[model samples]
Target chain A: MDVRTRNNVVVTGREDGPALLLAHGFGCDQNLWRLVTPILAERFRVVLFDYVGSGRSDLTAWRPQRYSRLDGYAEDVLEICRALDLRDVVFVGHSVSAMVGVLATIAEPDRFAKLVLVTPSPRYVDDGDYRGGFSQADIDELLESLESNYLGWSAAMAPVIMGNPDRPELGRELQNAFCRTDPAIARVFARTTFLADNRADLPKVPVPTLAIECAQDVIAPPEVGRYVCDQIPGCRLVTLDATGHCPQLSAPEATAEAIAGFVES
Target chain B: MSGLEQDAEDLYENAPCGYVSTLPDGTIIRINGTLLTWLGYTRDDLVGRRRFADLLTVGGRIYHETHYAPLLAMQGSISGIALELRAADGAKLPVLVSSTVKDTKVIRTVVFDARDRRTYEQELLRARRQAERLAGTLQQTLLPPSLADVPGLRIASHYHPASTDQVGGDFYDLFPLADDRWAFFLGDVSGKGAAAAVVTSLTRYTMRASAVHNPDPVAVLRDLNAVLNREYAGADRRFATVLTGLLVPDGDGFAVTMATGGHPPALLISADGSAEYQHIPGGQLVGPLRDAHFASIDLRLRPGDTLLLYTDGLTEARTAHGRYNEQALREYVLTRELTTAPALVEELTRLLAGFGEGLDDDTALLALSVPPA
Candidate 1:
């Protein structure tokens, strides 16, 4: 296998163990997976990387139009799999990255063995026939708030995004971290993460899948998580008593345990 | 503290409005004669007998404790907030309140009659509601009663207004042209509200009329552009991005001939789950020039293929950190394997709804799918 040293893709672990690839979601870089890495490091060849346009990745590789779609993200995933030349790999993706894993697996089913999707949502809109917990009007209000005051909206939306507005400091921390992102890239990424609906692609995923549902998560509620599992063939749904969007941040031990169980099984 | 003897003190006791003083915890420490009279209570009935919150209406009390009191404590003073007092007759008296925290940990709350300002605000709200209703009704009329039904196709369209009280410039129409052709256009006029509504109405009417006379998509846009340029070119300098397409039924499918005036490309999702955006280059803004150039693109819609027409609202929608551009649309459409038009439009609408709050402009979506024979 020809290995390409693209930015943000870090491969480190005992080469003798099973291969596991860890991916983070939007508004965060690879550091988010840090808490869970050491726990898994003992048994698996843990591969970690930032998605393009995030963290210490090659900023010059960022293309506004190309990165605007999640498929480009899936492309990077496949590239990482090719570069690492790993077989029977367990792919773990958080938040929107979970959907990215689905797309990537669909693109190259032979490259991956199993997928562990954390808080995955195929659709976020409510229709007459379907419910994703939000209405078009609600999205409009959120967009307007974002445009009217980007910084203030980020600060206010942080707690909501973090799933606890009462913890003002958490909201502040999220805002500060989110503000570190390039405004233009962040805006495009925001659109891509929220706007694209991959409900139709769920059925096409051929690999064994595990949908890790967060019990108290407002971002990916129980109903939506169950719906996602129902759509994917031969997929198991496990609900963890995690509160926020980032379970690795709120309940790292439970999250790690779940992954460990899934991988062992 | 003899106040020019007791005679002069009597004048202050009889003054209008209410006054009360309380400790930091809201325990009543003092009450004046005027406030006592208004509540039909004597000095003994109020002073040290009840908290200042007791005289307020239920909502007023809640507001005072939750917002007013806390704000006052944090800021040392709060003023000019409206509140309601429970009067002697069990009626509510509207009043403006100002509160200050003193060094003694006592809070002095001064109340003033706000009947005039209250009345003015009520009238203002009523007028605003009336204006909003008018705009809503007018905007409703600007849209087609229903999109014209075409044979061999399943269609569904949705229009999201930006503001309830004001109409936006985005508009879409699906109508039949003479001789078995259907012309549909989705466009966004510059600016928003009433002025944009006028342009939207005119564009919709003009497109229909122009299509009746010339059955070609490019010709219809050209003629509409001339009219809009003539009408709105001078002081307003209004323009719009429009995509007009003519659908003609072919063998088990329809041939879509579309012309673009700086509009986003239409998405075509084939039966096998492959999707691509119809590239129409050199499409300039309509109504900006006397002779604005427009580009037309042609595509053969096969059985189980879906064509989606939309305004820039979809592409420009904000995501987590970026705009929902053509690339995302391509990725989404490519993965879905949409077999019908309703499926295509349904997914598009779902995508738009997901972008929620990030989609600032008014969005209009129209989808046409050729059924499998």
Candidate 2:
């Protein structure tokens, strides 16, 4: 398989510098790193790409059996590193991609030099003796909401009077294009993400790691981040004052500064 | 404050859908009466007391924080998001919400009461699931209950459905004919669901009826082809690929005469630890054509020799290594020291299970072998 086309890989920055691979999370694509990529690009060869089922990657490569588990995504990461001949690379992952990076790094520790995780959660559902925050019922409702949302989007194809009329085109674009994921792929991805249990895989990281937890994050709470830090050996935990799940988007400067400090040190 | 015909109070208080304005963190700031009434809440109960996420069920809250909130933060607006709200009295209220961030601070949400819509969708889902169950049950009645055990042969068969929701076209049966002779056939129809099921039931009964009159494998298929062509040779014409065989006890084994109608070649494993495909070349698809010809091959099944007939679903199943084509199947069987029919069928069942999601089609396997006496 052509790794570049399959993953929609975009490589920039100086060729002589070390490589920084950025993996996006569930909702958006590689564009999630739009704010942080420029800052990192000045010092490193920035690599940004989308998972096969998301963004502009080749959707035909999505096979349910292959992508049923997180290992398939890890294989993509390893394959990307192999294709670019990237050695001792710094891997930066957001949301569920953090766990994806953990799996990849564990599989081949020599390839990744440093790890940066943004709002990462090893498990979403609360198990015994662990507060992963959400429950199994909540994940099921999330799936139901996705189905209902997909139904609304598809059923309202013939332009209805829903949102503001002043910026009708913006409303239309939101209904038609923005954050548009294939309903089937999105459902499977949601199940794979929210239902996954990677707590056991967290302690296996062999490289220096950084866990950035956002304040008041409803998805990955601060406690989950601390748990990740405590499990992994010699890992540093940084809690951002930025609210919401995405610190990279809400407060890119601080997020980039935190990442820059880790990479430089 | 404006004296215009469409005043701010008129729009906010009596909009078609429920409107709620909240802080960036989903804390309720100002809400409309329509939303308050739908949730059985007073103004003081929600306005400053609760965030928007707090009103949702455990699941909806997670979806709101993870998917909805993130999208609103990134894109500044999200439309037509379906979520369930927990009412004041613990009832579930399904709502379609559209929210937008104003100046990257306040969040203005428009919620549509989707109780009726949700009910209709649920009904549709229920009806679809019911239809799938009915189709599945009907599909089961088309095949034989059990393969009758012949004195000289050890036989076993398996049917694997890629999906339990819809009925597939693959089928197999092994039954007694007359005078200590046994008849067995495995075939796959062209389509799926109820229509294909009708064709399958007809083909099975017709093969049995035709075989009783004329026990020749080729003649039996010819008769079935004639019946199917006469019945369904119209616009919605259905066809089938069948491999029918008649097994008659010879000495310590059986002589098998099998005919193929565009079906996959059967595998013959010899007692000498070798396997080869019994390819029948000039066979045409049964039904859809008036004169579909079939050819029969005669093979002597010696002691410790096994013969396996199957549908194309086995050979055409997609695998990580590529399609499990005839050559791959031949290589797999050639490598295995297959002695009994049951063992070979069990191994093939495991191989099919290994395909997982790649095996999108239904498969039917029927094996007949002479045990080493």
Candidate 3:
């Protein structure tokens, strides 16, 4: 399908409960949240949509200059909330989407009630005072890899996402899914996701916040997750004993259970 | 075999390129056609007598046993690879060859003429060098012959292009506004190459023209934004991250009102060795939409305070082990306490040199420091 036709707002589940907005991160679209959505649908209104540059999203709206920064994606989240008139909404953002949620909440604090950040990182580049887990060289290599061979990057990155070489099928599946994205948008998103430094906005998040971390996640480790929670006020950190970056993919039942309890509490 | 069949086999053994068949240990069992012809040998001279290594140039033989042979044995086959063959005349013929173990007892090999490809590759290398030289000349033409020298402030600037062949989008300029006020800006246009260079030129000219009528930093940025949006909207969109400021001399230093359009924060280094980034929040990108909002920050530069403006290239430079981050730059400035424009530029240039190729983007640095009066 063309990218413009892909941009869609899908509302699923019961209409009576609190509304929940689900945002996927860099590589995957709303499909990443597939397993967890059904459980949330039983008790809450689950809203899922592809970001403008992503799957089934409007390619016409995907301006490279605008989407080059994470704040552009954050603006889309706020716009989506405003369109739905979603108040006291619980925003669950995965990977870089977590940082996007932070920026969106900072832009309009009244619209969001809580932010659930899944495998989120404000800054991936490590500083002497802060341990962002990856060095500048690591990110540079990633950018180089992306530029040299987009398909090769997906192939190389899939194993890291799978978290195990023994699970070759999982790596194959992840690579196949990542290959579905347009090369141009994927390149822009890759640059935007790895290059942003949103740590400054962490403390400005006034709403309740929860950072969900995957214990074995190479992308967003547990320590980084704790760092995020520590930066935001009155924020809680939870670690799932999942092996991959996408906990909602690896352990959906546990991930959904954690979110449901956190929101209810 | 009959005399007629043997004569037919002799023709196959004697074709122009050197050919050899050996056991898995590389002991020659058969040598063929032009290989025997070139090697000054006959069928009776080489059959089951010579090793394949005996036919290689000394260096080629050494490399073959050390790397090529072991690799080929492990991989089952190796091909079209460069190697030198030793001619009977003791001269080396640069050739490409393919070798594979046909069986545990024998190896099959084929040799082809590669003098043409090697010559072609050399010519290509020379042409690439010429193209790179021409690209360097074109890239320099994209930058101003020199940054406009504004009076009153000791101004020194530097523009470092990431690649000579492709022009980068980083640019900076200082010019006069009405009422004795001076307007200056440093910005990075999105993307690179000739297309980005065009946008960089457009932005610099638009900013200069807009400031003549509207000296306010915010207003000037708005005008530029309007022009850019009008020119580069829709499918052919282009945008820039810019920091524009109005410098009015106050006391000894200048009182500056800076507006940012999704650019990095400006660094204010005081004479007392204190340096801080002028943080402007919510500065949207310019030229994506018709009405893009830019944020402005006000800071009074005291005597001995030097304001350093730069593109993202500097902060995003990758180090050998890590990135040359904002914190590192801040700490570097704090330690030096640079009070003059020249001193700041010198230090920054040194830092850029240390970054080397890691700083793979155009970097523009403009520093304005007011001396104590």
Best candidate, TM-score: 2
**Where does candidate 3 stray beyond 4 Å?**
A1-265, B1-114, B177-180, B319-323, B371-373
Q: Per-residue alpha-carbon lDDT of model 2 for A51-80, expressed as tens digits?
A: 877777777677777777888889989999
Models ranked on lDDT: 2, 3, 1
Of the two candidates 1 and 3, the one with more favorable lDDT, higher being better, is 3
Give per-residue CA lDDT, model 1, range A170-239, as digits (tens).
7556544432344456667766876779999999998989999877554567998998999999999989
Q: Estimate each model's TM-score.
A: 0.52, 0.71, 0.44
Kindly report which residue pairs in candidate 3 clash with one another: A6-A56, A6-A57, A7-A56, A7-A57, B13-B33, B14-B33, B15-B33, B15-B34
Candidate 2: which stretches are off by over 4 Å?
Answer: A1-13, A26-31, A48-76, A123-130, A135-204, B1-5, B22-29, B40-51, B72-77, B88-90, B101-107, B143-196, B209-215, B229-293, B297-373
**DockQ for each of the predicted structures, in order?**
0.02, 0.19, 0.01
Selected candidate, larger DockQ, 1 vs 3: 1
Q: Write the per-residue lDDT of candidate 1 for residues B30-57, one digit (tens) a residue.
A: 7778777767877887777777767776
Residue A59 in candidate 1 has what lDDT?
56
